[model samples]
Target: MSAPKIKCPTCTRVIEYSDQYPHRPFCSERCKLIDLGEWASEKHKIEGNSIYDDLLSDDLEQPD
Candidate 1:
């Protein structure tokens, strides 16, 4: 059987999904780093409410 094909998340390049690809979803280290940079800079975020908001509200409601 042949390796499954997938597009690189960063560059949109078609790549074979196999053990040879250290960066599975990305084509290269550069592309992987770019994605990481985006996340570090808050360019990526999970949708929906976070528990941190409730925690902060509770903290604010209490005396400091």
Candidate 2:
């Protein structure tokens, strides 16, 4: 059987989902970094509240 094929999340380029591609979901390091940059810049986010939200808020509300 042949390795499965997938699209790179950043550029939508078709690639093989195999060990040959170190960046499995991405076509290359550049694409991987681009995705990471988007996340770091808050351009991409997972919907819904984070588990640490309440804990962080409580800590912030406390007197320093």
TM-score of each: 0.80, 0.77
The true-structure Cα RMSD of candidate 2 reads 4.0
Q: Tens digits of per-residue lDDT for model 2 on 1-64?
A: 8999999999999999999899878999999999999999999999987888967776666765
Number of clashes found in candidate 1: 0
Runs in model 1 lying further than 4 Å from the true structure: 57-64
Largest TM-score belongs to which candidate?
Answer: 1
True-vs-predicted CA distance for residue 5, candidate 1, Å: 0.1
Model-by-model lDDT, in order?
Answer: 0.91, 0.91
Worst 10-residue lDDT window, candidate 1? 55-64
- State the TM-score for model 2: 0.77
